[model samples]
Target: MAEASANIGVNFPPFLNSSSPTFLPSRTLKPEFPLTSKLKPNTWRTKPLNLTAFAPSSRLTSAAFTQTDDGKFQPRIEADNSRTGRVFFLDVNPLCYQGSKPSLRNFGRWVSIFFEEVSHSDPVIAVFDGEGGSEHRRLLLPSYKAHRIKFTRPPSSKRFTKGNFRTSYQVIRDALRSCNVPVVRVEGHEADDVIATLVEQVLQRGVRVVVASPDKDFKQLISEDIQLVMPLPELNRWSFYTLRHYLAQYNCDPCSDLSLRCIMGDEVDGVPGIQHVAPGFGRKTALKLLKKHGSLENLLSAAAIRTVGKPYAQDALTKYAEYLRTNYKVLALRRDVDVQFQDEWLVERDRRNDSTILSKFVENNDRNLLVQPSKQV
Candidate 1:
């Protein structure tokens, strides 16, 4: 992945790594979307003739100092408006590894590593995979995420059982709290939904959002100001993307949130996208239907057009309707999560100080890492 241009105000004047801190101008003017296609606009919200959202400022606000002035401390807050951009790190499987030695340590390790670097660039927010604490799909469809059910099973040994694993979750939760990061979990909802809720909210507020996760489902969230960063083999290095980038790859416009996603049902999340409708075909059908009936609902129920010979169209309509009702139950992110933004969540690192700050993380005894910190958020 290409790193942000150093001339872009990256803080590398006194750092160890070849990489430079990305100083995103919080005041970047939102880009204008030009109309070039004849696609119907009723089914999907037309790309506003002037589509713009919150753009992250290139600088930090009230950049308080924790290190020395000579750059020995490697300024933690480099950009002018520090808190301008909201960075959210979504943990897909917060408890993916619960059986190994100090299993919960994985969460700690990920958290520390993320903050240690982000603290130097932007204000970061983290949302962990709550083990179903909030309103989840179970209320709508009990079979949702049934595959991961083994995770919730009661452990025979108190130390290894589901209850114990949750206890370990509490440990990881406490560590995040001490760091001042927001840890959220809705009893019945998944972490993805919570993260989505946050992304959607920020996007609406015009604040740029960067969701950190490798899951393909998140691709749907990519927009002008909103982007994605996927971790690569290199520590801390990530692959970034925008909606246009995705359009280039898939050959379909992503501005239409429903048309784009409805056709390409997410298999990972068990969403059987548009029954027999091929991937890009959903986009076409959605556009055509929207042009005729004005909305997915109207298209599905249009009596005169129901006889169209496309089996995929009928199936698509059925699935689309079912999805409309339950997918949000499944896909719409949740903002009402009990999680609250905290200050300590921002991890700070002195680039000029020492490699050991984050280097020590690569190899440490899980036990020494502290399962749960004393503080709570």
Candidate 2:
């Protein structure tokens, strides 16, 4: 069930089309101030200008986003003590339905809603799943989420339609863009994978990364600095989870562990954990049993096993082993994704730190309804 490629072609804003007249060629100077005596041959270094060169007002060019730190940049708010946080939101599964629906517009509304709620707090970067993405994972592993696709009734006249799905996706993208949010999408990878890659990159830069998606699968990425934020309609009602708590609650540990998928396979991905076993139950069993016998390989090798559950270990050996093997692959999240950021992705502008700096932008952009709230949520 691959997504149609045409849908992946979400339009992005064009690059700066015309350079300004201020971008002029620097005139060669006859060493008005003697060049450094040990200057390397052929190297033309700009003499340190006066205090004006160091002033915040002098470096107002938009190019600062890409050029600061010599092109290696990460997004940051203005120079302030405020913590830098990157929020990633994902457009999840689509329920196919009939007839034309305004999806893009709806998503735009949601994006507007999201921005209106949190735009004042931190810098946000968003990404969308391209076509043929999450669905492709199933093709790679037959049981990736086999359980969810089970057909309920006999063949009928009705068929799946993607009309509303497409509209919803575009709505989010456009809304985000209308508010100047950076939305990214890459073909052939699910939004989860892209989010993982982005999270990994920024975590190394001492920034707190929060993924704003409802997918439980992203639990695998939870860590000290990398947390999961499930926001609610009531701003203060959001839920935050850490990796340690996740591991303890879920009965599965990603650290120093194998791909056993916590023992129980995920039915959502067609993984059959311990054959007839259920989702959370199978996982709990695998984690507990492995704790006693060591690895799945060792658990199978043991002549006798202890358990508090049904169907003794030996009787379910092959089933459990296979479940562990298959589910591990299914549970594995791809942490490597090629998201090339231009140098501009970093380097905070003076205006970014002040909500007032964006006032003019909000007034001019109809899509942007997020006014700096008179008070914080």
Candidate 3:
């Protein structure tokens, strides 16, 4: 295990003060064990396995739930002073879609940047989009992600044919395998769902995760234990989107983000918003409704009881209840995907082989891949 310095701190809100045992301090504390120990053999249990090898220590703590004045018991997560393990989840689909011309070499450059600048010695798991990745979503709504195929299609260039895409993907996979990074692709499941399930699984072991992708759909997954790092091609860097950034931008909790998106449809995915289905329901209206009601379900319930302030908003909800529900189903990421975490996935990187692969992809002018500070979303 890497010795955590006292200076290293996690990004958590300062105002939350709790003395509960479940409250972990928002700082990196010293770990009692080393990072090189082998984990116990897996029994293929139904429940979450005790991944002590990945945790800071053997003891596991669950977030404490407290009853608020409103009679709701909400989970309270205070930063524990204990050391927290970190992992990076790289989404390969977005990386392939980046820039005007997608080059096989860019895959190597991106992975190299992550290890050299973002992850350092931390473990990374590269997730690729499985075959028929969007099939399940499209089954729910045939229009789901219908517009993305044309946008993601490789341009008519001799260097970027459909065959070349497959070749590039295989080369990148081989390179990552040689460097000891686990490349994951589940049959008929998108990388987003796989990453989501993996994030949930890893969080149970008290490990923090950084999801590397530019997709806004990942915003709903941001929390104290998880964050999204978006790529910025113009600046040649990556930026983080944390829980703090999400709250600042939406003026609501990250949990409500899905509901907000339900009301304001994703143009890229071809999902129609309530504004299109029911006029006068734009982003501002959706935000205001979400801030007051907290979620699409609650807003719909309020509308049913005729308690929602505006008559038009209530009518819109009542009329488009099924549509909104379908939207939620389409947008909500599945966390129940059957994906197991492997101890071997946390193995150390082969720096020599990694450097060799990176050198093959690097141009002479491309140097100094420093991590830039996160910009406001």
lDDT of 1: 0.43
Name the runs in model 2 displaced over 4 angstroms: 1-113, 119-121, 143-168, 231-237, 244-248, 251-262, 275-284, 290-311, 314-320, 347-377
Instruction: Give a tens-digit lDDT track for model 3, residues 1-377.
Output: 11111111122111121122221222222233433433222211233322111112222222233335754434454444342456678898667543533444565667777666566545678887776778878888888866553113333465445553444445556666666677888777888998999887777755567888888998887665676777777766666665545545655556678898888888778788888867877788787787667778988988887767577777899989999999999999888776777655544344456677667655521431211112111
Candidate 2 lDDT over residue span 204-257, tens digit each = 543455666556677666544455655343443334454434444544433314
| Residue 45, candidate 2: alpha-carbon lDDT | 37
TM-score of each: 0.55, 0.52, 0.73
Positional deviation of residue 57's Cα in model 3 after best superposition, in angstroms: 18
Lowest lDDT 10-residue stretch of candidate 2: 9-18
Q: Cα lDDT of all candidates, in order?
A: 0.43, 0.42, 0.61
lDDT of 1 by residue, 122-186 (tens): 43455555544333465564544443421232335634544434444445444444444455555
Worst 10 residues of 3 by lDDT: 1-10
The TM-score, computed over Cα atoms with residue i paired to residue i, of candidate 3 is: 0.73
Q: What CA root-mean-square deviation does each model show from the true structure? A: 15.5, 16.7, 10.5
